[model samples]
Target: MNKSNRRKFIGTAAAVIAVGTAASAMPLSTGKENYPVLHHVFFWLKNPDSKADRDQLVQGVKTLKKIPSIQQLHVGITADTEKRDVVDSSWGVSELLFFKDLAGQAIYQTHPIHLEFIEKYSHLWSKVVVYDIIEA
Candidate 1:
């Protein structure tokens, strides 16, 4: 290749590297305070089959509301979202809880209230999934 071709290739490579680096350096926002350690516990449930199942889920939410260790508790079906391509807003029910720290989260996991909640709802649904996230 000639000098001009080599120069053009180098310039294109540099531009690509710069763009890639900039994108990597940019941190995506979680829409919440960047706590040193964050525990995100999620649960997905199959559609309820009976009135009994629905009733039991309600009892589970009520039980969670009574737990002091559960700083926040939410239970409901996902709402309609206009931005369907950017977000997932579909599920049967969800419960959200906040703790002071990791220790608090552990405590919540073993707390009697939580145990009772599990017992109450475990049979209400056909499936469940949980995700715990700890971020720095």
Candidate 2:
């Protein structure tokens, strides 16, 4: 390429890199706060594709919002995506719970609302996996 073309190409590449760096530096809304505890649960239903089962699980998740200790609750279904070796698409529903701290999570575990939710909806899922995380 000519010198002018090379310079233009270099400038464009630098601009692209700068834009990407700026975007990455911006704060993302992952909702993690200092010392917050996140409880993530993935459920595989006995009938994974059953709309009724999914609806029931969603309802049960919503009920947990009654517990004051919970900072946030998000319920969602598996996303549609290309099959990949590392992706686990077997789960039918996912529940994300955010608690202010470990104490808040401890209270949530034994809260009546939480217990009722489990008692009422435990039968819907054949497999459940829970991952708890604490922000540093």
Candidate 3:
């Protein structure tokens, strides 16, 4: 290759590498907030078709938001989608809770509001699955 072509190719390669390095180092979250711990819970209700049961569960979840240690809370119902082999729509309700750290989550676990929530709403769901995640 001629000197001009070689110089252009080298410059292009250096630009690509610089862009990739900067992208990889960028923070994933918005600068205003940082939630490192995530607690996800899925609930399979005893009577999935009953609106009363769903409403009761939703109400119970709202009370949980009052807990001081919880940074964020989201409660949702499973969405209707195309039936597929991999889809698992058995869960009637899903809840996501975010905390600043594991210590905050620990406090939430034993908080009176959380315990009260369980006592009030445990009988509505037959199965529950919880997944906890920490940011790397």
Candidate 4:
């Protein structure tokens, strides 16, 4: 290879290695005591019939957002993007909730607000998936 080409290749390889090392060494979360973790729950609707079910689920998730224990609540409708193997995007809606701890999450789940939401929108979707992860 030409001298210029060899230099460019070496520089690119070094840059890649540096980025990979930095990413691996980065800390997950700040060193705060009892750092809060985010709980993500997704609902996959088998029936993609009409706007009615989506609207109901949105309203129910909004009610959940109003509860006190929940630090954050986010509802995401699947985007028309490239598919990934991990998520089964055949469903209609995905709900994400964040809490300080398991106790807080449990309260959110069992609270009257959440119960009411379930009663209202439970039948709209056929399947539900939940995922919880704590920051390191």
TM-score of each: 0.55, 0.74, 0.75, 0.68
Error (Å) of candidate 1 at residue 12 is 71
The per-residue C-alpha lDDT of model 1 at residue 88 equals: 61
Candidate 2 lowest-lDDT run of ten = 27-36
lDDT of 2 at 133: 96
Model 4 C-alpha lDDT per residue in residues 32-99, reported as the tens digit of each score: 54527777777866467667778778778877888788887788887787888975667788788888
Q: Per lDDT, what order, best first?
A: 3, 2, 4, 1
How large is the C-alpha RMSD of every model relative to the true structure? 12.5, 8.1, 7.8, 9.4
Which residue pairs show backbone clashes in model 2? none
What does candidate 3's lDDT look like per residue over 1-136, in tens digits?
A: 9999999999999999999999999888755568999999999999999989998998888899999999999999988999999998999998999999999999999999999999999999999999999988
Error of 2 at 11 (Å): 43
Residue 133 miss distance in model 4 (angstroms) = 1.6
Which 10-residue span in candidate 4 carries the lowest summed lDDT?
30-39
Can you give the lDDT of residue 90 in candidate 1?
42
User: In model 2, what lDDT does residue 66 have?
Assistant: 92
lDDT (C-alpha, whole model) for all candidates = 0.64, 0.92, 0.94, 0.80
Residue 35's lDDT in candidate 1: 35
Compute the lDDT for candidate 3: 0.94
Which 10-residue span in candidate 1 carries the lowest summed lDDT? 34-43
Candidate 4's TM-score reads: 0.68
Clashing residue pairs for model 1: none
Relative to the true structure, candidate 2 reaches a TM of 0.74
**Two-way lDDT contest, 1 vs 2, winner:** 2
Error of 1 at 125 (Å): 1.7
